[model samples]
Target chain A: MTVEVDVTIKPKRGVADPEGENTKKALHLLGFRNVRSVKSMKTFRIELELDAETTGDAEEEAVTSAVEEMCEKLLSNPVIHDYEILIVGRQIGN
Target chain B: MTVEVDVTIKPKRGVADPEGENTKKALHLLGFRNVRSVKSMKTFRIELELDAETTGDAEEEAVTSAVEEMCEKLLSNPVIHDYEILIVGRQIGN
Candidate 1:
């Protein structure tokens, strides 16, 4: 089976985003008023291959584990950031 | 007129992404091999209110200017990052 995943990570609200803040200032200078907040996000496309017999539970477990592990390990900064994951493509029972 | 913009910003390839690099190292520790690259991106949802008579050209120019300004001002660091924009919804001739 093959799968594609899209992931986004952003600093939690109210936490200072230097990049976002600087951008806000620039927008104000450019005359865009009423601009509220600026947040950042990241997306990923991951492709994985697995065997037939191990398709169902194994695939799910593997992905779940990988995502969680990735989040904790590299995708997010637990203290200041949050992440969202979307599974784009999935195939089963083939 | 109303419009929705989804923007993504990331460091150019071969540029060092500290956050991405840390995550990559973590993934390696967790045993996911062959991982190629990790990049960070940000999305913005902007809603603007404009009048009827000024809808056509004004809206286009305003948005184009706003987007460019925003990218230079806040969305991306011109020296190291790149950005892409997608307009999600648009209503004209109302």
Candidate 2:
């Protein structure tokens, strides 16, 4: 089975988001007065090949663990960012 | 009412994604052979203030129009990138 995950990395609340701030300012300058705030984030769509025989809770645990490890090691910075992982889709026999 | 929209900007299917490539390579080096592919994207969580009285289809249309206009004007590059918008959550009042 192949598991597809979406990992969204966002700045922790109260952390500085200079890019978002700049974008908000630019939007305001452009006349979007109703715009209140903007928070920027990064997302990764990842496909992982699990054993074709893997299924049920075991498969879910395996995929979640692998994805979380990947996020901790390389995908996101733990210092100021928080990440959320969702198993969006799955393909069988891949 | 205030509408929250999540705009995801991703590289088009055939477009080059150096960041994704590098991440994939890095994961491979880190011994994650199960990683098939990775696609990186940018997301903006935007908060827009609509008229307090606006609701139903009209409110939805208004938010969609405003967000699309923002994307076209500054948020994303349409040439090499494609975007998806999702209205995840909303608040009753500003």
Question: Which residue pairs show backbone clashes in model 1?
Answer: A23-B74, A41-B41, A41-B42, A42-B41, A74-B23
Best by TM-score: 2
Question: Which stretches of candidate 2 lie above 4 Å from their native place?
Answer: none
What is the Å distance of residue A24 in model 2 from its true position? 0.8
| Candidate 1 residue lDDT tens string, A1-94 | 5555657677787777777666656667777774544444556545444555555567677766777677777667899988777665765533
Over 4 Å off, model 1: A1-4, A13-19, A42-65, A87-94, B1-4, B13-22, B42-65, B77-80, B87-94
What does candidate 2's lDDT look like per residue over A1-94, in tens digits?
Answer: 8899999999999999998999899999989998899999999999999988789899989988998899889998999999998899999885
lDDT string, candidate 2, B1-94, tens digits: 8889999999998999999899999999998899999999999999998888888888888988998899899998999988888888789965
Q: Lowest-lDDT window of 10 residues in candidate 2 chain B?
A: B85-94
Worst 10 residues of 1 chain B by lDDT: B33-42
What lDDT does model 2 reach? 0.91
